[model samples]
Structure formats: C-alpha cells, structure tokens
Target: METIQVVFLTVLVFFVIVTIHEWGHYYFAKRAGILVREFAIGFGPKLFSIKRGETRFTLRLVPAGGFVRMAGEDPEIVDVSEGQTVALRVKDDKVTRIYLDRLDERSGVVRGEVTAIDLERDLFVSLDLDGEIERFRVHPQALMISKGKETQIAPIDRQFGSKSVGARAMAIFAGPMMNFILAFVLFAVCVQMAGVPKENPDKLFVGSITDKSPASGSDLKRGDTIFAVNGTPIGGNFKLMVDIINKSKDTAVKFDIIREGVKHSVNITPAFDKESQSYRVGISADPQTRPATFMETFTIAGKQMKVWTINIFEGFKKIITAQFKLSDIGGPVRTAQYTSQFAAEGIDKLTFWTAILSLYLGIFNLMPIPALDGSRLIFIGIEAVRGRPVNPNRESMVHFIGFALIMLLMVVVTFNDILLLVRGEQ
Candidate 1:
C-alpha cells in the first residue's frame, strides 16, 4: 500500500543516516585501538543482535538513532575494597554477585565502601561511609568495580589521548565528513534521474516584481529575458535566487536582460523578504528546463549536495536564534505523511525528497550543538588545543547535560508533531 511504502521509505532513510553516523565513531575508535563493546542501531530493548569478534551489533526497538559503546570508558585504577567489614571469602572460587537498590538508573561518580558480602548470593552489600553510595549489579563478565577517589582506570584507551592532534581531529571530523559524503552520493543519483532546473532568458516570466522595488527602476521589463545574472549565464532562477538571498542587503544584483530583442543591463538592490528569507529585486522567474547530459547529471548532483549543506547550516542558525520555532520543525510523523504525498506524485518525486531528507540528516547531526557529532568534535578540538585531553569525568558530565537538554527539546518537538498531526486528521 502507499502508506506502507511511505513508512518503509522513511525508516530506510532514517536508519541509513543514523547507522553511518554511529559507524563513523566506531570505525575511528577501532583505528585508535579503543575497545568498542557494542554498536547498536536504535534504542530500548534489542530486537536482534549478532556478535562479530568483540563488537556486538544490535538492532534495537527504536529506529531513531544508534550508538557505538566503546570500552575503557570507566577509568577505575585501584580496586582495593578486598578488606571489608564482613568479607566472606569465595567458597569455591566461584563468581561473586551483588545488587544495589537500583543500579540501572544511576550515572556519574558513585563513591562507596563495601561493608558486607553475602557469598551464597554472591552479592557485595556496600555502605556510603565516605560519599554517596552508588549501586552496582554483578554480571557474568568480570566486574570492573570503582570504589571511590582512589579508582583510576583510564575509561577509554590511553592511546586515544596519546594520539597526535591531527589524528584526533581527523577521528572527530570523520562523522560529519561521512554524512557529507552520503549527501553527495544521494544528490548525484537524484540529479541523474531528473534534469536540474534552470532559469532561461527565453522562458523568463515574472512571478512577482513589486512596485518601488529596485527592479522597477531598471530598463528591465517584467517579461524581459534574463540572459544572465552578474555575467554568469543562468539556466534557471534557483541558483541565482539562492545566491541573491545569501548576499548582503546592500549588494546590487546585475541582470543581463533582452527585452523586445534589445539587450539591456539592470542592476537592482534586493530587499529581504522574511517569509523566504531571500533577497529579491522583487521579481520572480518562470521555471526553465535544463536537461542534464549523463556526465552533467552526476556533476550537478555534487553541486546540489554542496548547496544543501549551506542551506542546512543556515536553517539551524535561524531556529536557534528564535527566527523559527518548534512548529517550524517537522518530526518523523509529518515526514511519513509528506513522503506519502510525494510518492503519489511518482517515484521521481519520492526519490528526490529522499535525497533531500538524507542530506538534511547528515548536515544537522554535524552541527556543533550539544549531544551531537559536532559537539563531540568540539570537545576533541579543545583537547587538541590544550595539549592534554579533557578529564573523562568532566567531559561525561557535559555530555550528560547536553543529552538531557536534547531529550527535553525532543519532547517539545514531539508534542508539536502530534498536535500538527491531530489537526490534520481533524
């Protein structure tokens, strides 16, 4: 069914972007000789898994995102809790176990002293004689217990910090770089399928050219043929419009026009329009076709990829600045509906939108916001500049804060998403 296709396509796009993003971390960590325990796609309970060597690859219940869990994340050096109040020595040298009131939820530094050990249950009951007592659960794997300030096991690999600055930078940038690569590939494919749009002089028809606008003062007429903008031959208005919008308000855009078979030059200072955030000489152009050659199609795709990257960054900036709000953002629910609508138009539209969405994901994750690949890179950059790696405890705390903020934002966005969906249904 159409709905099924829409859902399937949306999931495919989401997973591909997420998996590559996580893999970026996993690949570099391995290259740096860091131990990675798990690389999982999605969240919640594991739906399926396969172990390959030391890494366990899992497909989780939630398809929103994924993670590469690397080892050495716990830097506990000294395990000197052997001499305790009630130390029951191992009867058969068997595995020991212990349970805190609730071990799953607690994170951050948990300092405690083990006052008792029940050998039969293999549990180590501890008391917070010094600081806060954090619970720990005993598992099959050898427990890497941390007992307080004295504990110092390099959480991640020592070599991770020991690596050259350039190496660390490369490892950090790899995630975003991979996303850019994905956008480029997708853009190329989309371009090949459908010829790029262009603005042609012969097809120039004004969409809107406001009065008192700079265009009104020029020799250029409404239906005038636009041969080029600033001497660059424009096949279509999309690129030229994009350029105009990105330029400063005071910049004069020159258009070479042919009106009634007579060539003329028009220079107009574009005014900013908030709705589109594009500078306009108060003129719009008719859509012109630019059929791509086989080679040209591939090249154009790469071009579009670059264009999308810039747009994504600008959009995020606008949102952060309060120029846009949560309502302006769309979640997966809306994406699915939009995908279905586009799919109805035909496969070409669906594919094009898919490429666009993919590019969006790749670029957005690269943003230097907290709880993102970009933020991780920023931390890495700090380490590179400081000549010493950031303290793991501090860095983890920062990330936790970022994670919490991200979760709160997600809740708001999801609430907005549901509201929009219900309104549409009504």
Candidate 2:
C-alpha cells in the first residue's frame, strides 16, 4: 500500500512537471506561427489522444518524459519505392478512398481508394495500392499526386526549420523557462502557506541535551539561551552556532549562555563521532517560524530559489571533482521513496520537495548535453552564427546518441538506488 502511494505521487508530480514543460514549447511554437504536430505527455505508444486545432494531444504509456513535436523538427524521408500501395484524395473532398493494385509503371495517373484520412497531418490521406498500404507525404499547402513517374516536394512555411532563429530559440528555451517559473511559483506558494522561519535573535534556547554527551557534562541546560560561542556572537543563526560547536573537535569551546536572567560562560570539548563523521556536542534547538506576508513570501521564495540553484551547481561541481560519489546519485526509485516519505510527513514537506524537484529539473535540462534543450539551443546558436541550419540528419544523430547515453546513465543510477534500498532493508 505504501509503495502504491509512492508510485502514485511520483507519477503525479512527474506528469505535472513534464506537461507544463511541453506546454511551454507548445504555447511558444503556436505564438511564433510554427505548426506543432503533437503535444504528448510521456513517450512510446499512445494511451489516449485527441486532436484539436491542428495538434494532437496525447498521453503515452511511459511517464519518463514528454515532448512537443513541432513540424519538420525531425522530418522523415519517406521511401516511396518501399511502399507497395498509394492513397489518393480527390480535390475539395474531405473523404479519401483506398484502391489496391493501382500502380502502373508505364503511366503516372493511377486511381486508388483512400483507406485512412488524417486531418492532423494536414489532409494526409492513406491508400492501399498494389495490395500494400502507403502514405503520401506532402505539405498541407500543396497537395501532390504522382503518376507512377516522379515525386514532387512541397516546402511548408509553418515548419520548425522555416521559423526565424529567434523564434526557434524561444520555442526551445520555453520548456526550461516554464520549469523555472513552476519552481518559483511553487516556492512562493509554499512559503506563504507554511510561513518563513523567524528565528529569535535574543537567544538560541536549547531544546534538549543528549545524555552522556559533551553538552551534558557541560553547563548547558534545557531552556538555556546561548548568546555566543567561542567569544563570537552567535546571533540568531542556529546553524552557525552548531557549526562552531561541531568544528571544535577535541578543543574546549567557550559558550556564553543566559539562563534564568543570568549570564555564564562554560567551556565544553566536543568528541568526534566516527559513525556520523562529525564532532558532537549533542544539543538540539527549535527554530521559530511565523506566517509570511504576501510580499515577504515572494521575497523568501526568490531567495530560496537562488539558494537551491546555487546548491545544485555546487553539487554538480562536487560530482565532477570526484568529491561526491557516483553511487550517491538517485534515480526514479529513490525519488519516489523520498516523495513518499515527504507525503507521509505532510503536504507542506511534499510541496517543498516538489518545488525543489522542479527547480532541479529545470536546471538539469539547461545543461548543454546532447538530447537536451541546451544542446538544441547550441545547434540553433551555430545556425544563427552561420546563417544556415545544420544538416538535420546529423543533428538528429547527435540527439539520438545523447539520448542513449542519458538512458544508460539512468539505468546505472537506478541500479545503484536499488542496491542502496536492498542494503537499507538488510
């Protein structure tokens, strides 16, 4: 039951983030007068689909990611010779009929019944010719008919390639931008709803002191307010005070405490704990928080976003510098577990993590790796500089390779996550 809930929460969050990201592309593409073929959530076989306003919106089986399929983004070269049959549509007719064995090698004009009519493909009609079905790929503006002789190509104006460089960049960048916007908004809402921490500056009151700990042997007591540490004013930052104490490994640190309206100084030495890998004073304090005003909430949210963004960059740096272990990386399984744990804690925690995940997703997608929006932007940048687009086939191959590598990485990380889970269970 718990696993089911975790899976459900994970899927829900994934769907929401991916849908918004794709919608960003769809919204900008349409605004830029580009034809969006499909706006799909998830990948692989479509589970459900609907056509509206020249775009097919679909839900697919896999929830890993989604995409906005713009026209001519990855155009396919249809091998007409491989097709055994041809579909033909009558001029000014909405319906198509397919005819079998209508191909004549000597003459061009062959009549056939159109078996399938796809309105989303811009009057794309399929027909069964010579006992095999084949689709005629033609631009929406210019319909073509071949008489068993030659093929004609019609250039479409509304394709992605036809769009200006600026427009193309906007469309590609919109996805990540939307993700950032999502994270920001979520953070703001969470702050407003949950309130911001309002630490008391007058004193840092100790909530508890561990038994048989260094703090227990010292003059520190519950309800005692710490005013300073090692002669440095602690201020209202509990983290700073804790850091000072933790860094005092085997060294006595002076603590200025105020208890019962009296001040006293005490020196306590912290012992290093190998298991936790930190010097322990073993005292905990409670942080006070108050509901934030509307403007304050926004300010807090903005600061939170900035801090988390920097943290992500730092984390990446650590990983690159080998300071962070690769096995520490978590995939979907670990993410789901965290989501579940957060959900169990409360809605506020879940919402906060959702914002964090959104920000991470946005930042990660902006990485200039192949198969990502950043990489696509790179190609677009090159095109802008050269005044011409890169060969679509080559660009497509690069994206394919990048996508394969990303999948491989996901597999490795997922395996690591599973191993960690198994170890935890044991």
Clashes of each: 18, 9
List runs of model 1 lying over 4 Å from the truth.
73-162, 196-291
Which candidate leads in lDDT?
Answer: 2
Error of 1 at 51 (Å): 1.8
lDDT of 1 by residue, 1-426 (tens): 376776676676677777777788788877876656778998789999888865789999856677777554434333334333222112234223222323443343333457543321343444454565533433223323333211112222333555566766666666667666776776676666655556333344443455577676766665667767777776555566557535747788777777788888877777777788767677666555566777887678877877876787788889878898568887656666677666654566667776777678767766777767677778888877787778888877877798788767666766788898888741
In model 2, where do residues sit more than 4 Å from their true spots?
Answer: 1-7, 77-85, 91-155, 199-286
| Tens digits of lDDT, candidate 2, 1-426 | 376776677677888788889999999999998877689997789999888866789999866688898877876333233234554444444333222234443243434555665433354656676677665543454323353322222235677888889999999999989999999999998887766667554446775577678888887876677788999897678888878878888899898988899999988898887888988787887444588988998898999999999999998888788887767778877887787777654566677888998888888888999999999999999999998889999999999999999888887888888998999831
Report the alpha-carbon TM-score of model 2 versus the true structure: 0.69
Task: For model 1, give the 10-residue run with minimal summed lDDT.
Answer: 148-157
- Clashing residue pairs in candidate 2 (N, C-alpha, C atoms within 3 angstroms): 85-129, 87-127, 97-113, 97-114, 98-113, 98-114, 99-113, 101-130, 108-147
lDDT for 61 in candidate 2 is: 82
The CA-based lDDT of model 2 is what? Answer: 0.76
lDDT of 1 at 23: 82
